[model samples]
Target chain A: MKAEAGCRACRGSCCGNPLVAELRGIPCNRRILLVGNPNVGKSVLFTRLTGVHAISSNYPGTTVGFSEGRLAFGNSCFHLIDVPGAYTLDPTNEAEDVARRIVDEGAEAVIVVLDSTALERNLYLALQVLERGLPVVVALNMVDEARHKGIAVDASALAEALGVPVVPTVAVTGQGINELVRALEERTRRAAPEAHSPAETTPPATLRSAEERWLVIGSVIQRVQRVTHRHHTWRDKLEDASVDRIWGGLIALAVILGSYSAIRLLGEGLIDHLLDPLANRLLLPLLEKLSAALGGEGLLHHILIGRLVDGAIDFEQSFGMLTTGLYVEFVMVLPYVTAFYTVLSFLEDFGYLPRLAVFFDALLHRLGLHGFAIIPTLLGLGCNVPGILATRVLESPRERFIAATLISVAVPCAGLQAMAVGVLGDLGGRYVLIPYAVLAVSWVILGRILHLVLPGYSPELIVEIPPYRLPSPSGLLLKLWFRIKGFLLEATPLVLGGVLLVNLLTMAGIVQAAARLTAPLFQGVLGLPPEAAGPLLLGILRKDVAVGMLVPLGLSPQQLVVAVVTLAMTFPCIATFIVLWRELGGRRLAASMGIMFFTAFAAGGLLHALFSLVGR
Target chain B: MGRQSSNFNPEQENLFRRTDSEEEALSNPAASEPPHPRQEAGGLRCPLRDVPNGRRVRVVSLPRGESGARLEALGIRPGKIVTKLSGMPFSGPVALELDGRQIAVGHGVSRAILVEEVPEP
Candidate 1:
């Protein structure tokens, strides 16, 4: 009954018991977990084994939580769970806490993924897991990289040292995966008899401390790993230069400028040459026929084709579920999303982000955050959902709150950025920079304020700066595909629904009344028309659609800047709001929203006053 | 592991010398005792922050708290050899190499990690 209850609760997704599987008419699965240190390519190994793509990166903490998938081999199936990377089982942070809990909860077998390049340090964790008495198959991952660095790890020696099977693997390619699976099969099969004899593997009454573990690990490493002198390659030079005090700063600046140019060039090219023509030549004609078939002016036509502006469909201004919704999501936003992720994924896979974090540490500390917060903030620029989720990598609750709040309020997602550019770019290139400038100022001011007000000290940066491996083209494309797929799935329906809701509200006369009620705030304080209220309201659901709504309002470029800035500072889109709540909980979420409202209004009013004084 | 007491520079030693009470306040009982014997024997000892870039040093002791434990977990424990690679100005993080891996430790954390220079082999 208890198993059935759990089965029902999870909808049979996580239930691994044979009886429960039989009752549900599904084959029983053996639970095998993959565990490793940060940046050890465990996620890649998980993907290889299960054929499920988990977002793998060159930096640490890419996976802040676990992901589950099923791997079928020979006859039996494996419910493979990729646990968050941990340096040790003795929990030092949240990720390690999750890892420790999962290991304690028990699995049919565990696969301890060891980085071949860092064998001595990696062995500390492997030994900890072995002391827990779990049946573990050691996956010596990244063997090729180790060899490239002139570090050789003897797999049989390592296995013999630990009394476990060690399979060397290069996860990026498919090398050694088949052998890994076979070794896993052999280990798990032998686990049956081993599980019955707890006395043999259970840790001693006097558990070893960290220093003691290191002592044992040192002996083990001496026998298994050999490091020889190697010539200094270009990669070594680049790595040194990247972290050099003067050179690191210069390189960081170059990276920022280069990334901006690349994103703009690629995004604009895609829109002009590809998506825009497709929408006009292919979709516009099809929509026109649908409009005419609907008798040119009805509820369906208004909702679907929207109002024809002077007998032509205006994709930007149309408040139709089909017209603006599809256009904004696919044409206006998707290209920018694609371009941004392409650049970000490359940086992630190239192992450059951690070095950037190092360069920014001193500056970030002034705002009560350490350098690692930049990862989440950078991610927020892509989309706030994962950005907020990545806050789990921060050590303290205070840091997570500050980081999440700052991300939601100051960091505009790619969708919002795309629409802002679309609306403001026509005014002038300079006009496009206004909202970004204001957002950057607000980010610093708000971060300082939060740091002053929040209790508890933020932990210092203790991140591993991974070696600069040339990013694999296939890995880059795969990661980009996963992010783009996520964007399409989460944004498509929301954009359509937001448009339909706007139409329905307009049809019911609610928009006019709401706009009227907010007239003084929009007209007097923010220097915008009363109709700006509608888009601001829509901004809560989808910021891109909200910015799109502003195009039809015909505000001046100054007012457009004011509106865009306010919209960005206000409530994040529904998806981000939900994630923030889940991450920050009710009390902190409320505090975060309160800050959002205050900042949005104050910034909007101040910008309005400044523009008015300047006579722009 | 050989001692090189003659390498001590009195001027540099004065830069890092701390009051006995301050050392006591920062020390954790659970960790090993302060490396006073090395200091008294005239070896050059200082916080990790004071170490010059590209110098190899052995960790002496860590501060008392989570950061120290975390540093240890990341292979910066006492008796380990680490090379100070780069340190940013304005109290930024110090990038160091341990066991052929690069690690960045923040300003406050670096200040609490005590290290002594290792004479070239």
Candidate 2:
């Protein structure tokens, strides 16, 4: 998948589904690609056109973020693909390659979404699209922002000049979206007739020289755009400060630490003020009543509501498919996942991520990864699957392996962290932080080792730092909704299934045999209990639930901390493992897992010795 | 993003480091000979990487192929005036302003690109 990610359409293995290369298939749908420069609201326009929920980020590259939506207009449905934004069709990057492929692969009509404010530069890409001789329409988007910047674009003049329909649109507000759709339908209909016409009538023009294209663009911009204001605004000041030497560093730090603290605070508060009271106080009593009503002892009661702690419900330790599973998933993990993605949504839309990536490029380079490599690692904090998939943004395989290995082995996703915090936070905040410290140190160490061993070149970063924007509240909420919804949709069943599997394993006595098999190693090297064996095995299925399993073992704070770090380091979850397999292929996946296991055991043993020596 | 061309392989750097003395002897047969440094970037033609930050330069030539063609299409061809912006201190991407937009190019492509420094007001 990693090899093919760059040229997926070129690989003719799956000819049955033409749309497979772009995104998911939409049955009986003609293709309509949303192509434009980065951060130009192409994804927002995609959502507005199709009402398909593809949350757009304001950052330059989001690794696995193309969407195919079913758009029905006037008894015709088309698959609207939101390809990654590119500056030009000449591919400078992987995303750009995907964009060029989608356009070159013969879409019915291509909608060139251009920023009205940056018309001159946007015209470079737009003119290239026009020269392709495909049915085309230009969506002169962000006109409202352009107007705020004292710029007004004449859509009619642009339409007449380009010889295609141009719809002036504010994609975020859905302004002129209907008109844009109407224009698209009419233009696409006009395309079929034009295709049959003489080649001389609308011949594919020779590729224009850069100077010639700029000359044409200059005249077009002069004709259509009217600049009313010459003075700089607060937005300009903010943009400058956000990238300034001292202030930019400070701002980047503030953005990272501030958002991190904000997420943690929000998640803890939700669990405390909302989810916990509902779970422990309200739901616990009711669930206990149900357990009692089911006679409270046999397989049904055990599977549904595991053994209670002192006749009271303990969500983490209960080990039930229903009781603890629901609480751990909804009450514990969901809050952190919700809060992290909420803040991430704001950062993405604020266009702060790329700037942050730029700011950290040099530092990341020392760690054997590109500056843009930070995106995948950071995204992995939200969830490892998408984070691993996001490695597609990196060009080469070695960088992906290094980033993926570090992420899987060190970075704990929100689910895992939430569980770690919930369990460890009870002991002390200091104790709760120990695993993260271990991971942070491990990130640099493992990265250096991987750099030494990995047999390929790491790609360098060449990314655009998108101009910053003040995120609209509605846009923030919409993005947050999509992320939270995705988490709920994906994690709920997996949590349930993981819990069911663990419980089934215990019932079959497989866990005992596994525990006895690993007991010598766990007890002697790690100074951990044999019961630690079960959670470590299940950690491969779901790290969050596995961490929850630690609560029942009644280990010391230091022991629990060691166990948490071990679990996080051992392996990515089954879903993430599959994605890693797809991305790194079979051989690389096996190598990484080998590294993961060796690291986990060695780290666990080292921590045990450290704890013993320090008497923690 | 840059014109990598698969020129640099990962194993070469480590292998070169391990056999550094042997390679030096092989390349320069006379161990006692006074080494004379070659004058590269001697005159008007220099790679973009060697250009100091804040220096405005005109694009002179780019490597031929898809990357070159694409770079040209984006208004970053010969005779276009561009200003080098902030370059990350290490061997990182060099930022340039061209066609009135800031673009970051990786060091590899910057090395491939030849530029002539120009004075700007």
Question: Per-prediction TM-score, please?
Answer: 0.92, 0.85
Residues A91-180, model 1: lDDT tens digits = 889999999988777777889998899888888888788877778888898899999999999998877778778899898897888888
**Candidate 2 docking classification:** incorrect
Which digits, one per residue and each the tens of the lDDT, describe model 2 over residues A89-139?
877666788888777776788889998877877888888887787777889
RMSD of 2: 7.6
What 10-residue stretch in candidate 1 chain A is worst by lDDT?
A19-28
Candidate 2: stretches off by over 4 Å: A1-29, A63-65, A150-152, A191-229, B1-121
DockQ-derived CAPRI band for the predicted complex in model 1: acceptable
DockQ for all candidate structures vs. native: 0.31, 0.17
Which stretches in model 1 have alpha-carbon errors above 4 Å? A1-29, A191-206, B1-25, B28-31, B34-42
Q: Once model 2 is optimally superposed onto the true structure by TM-score, how far is the C-alpha of residue A468 displaced, in angstroms?
A: 1.3
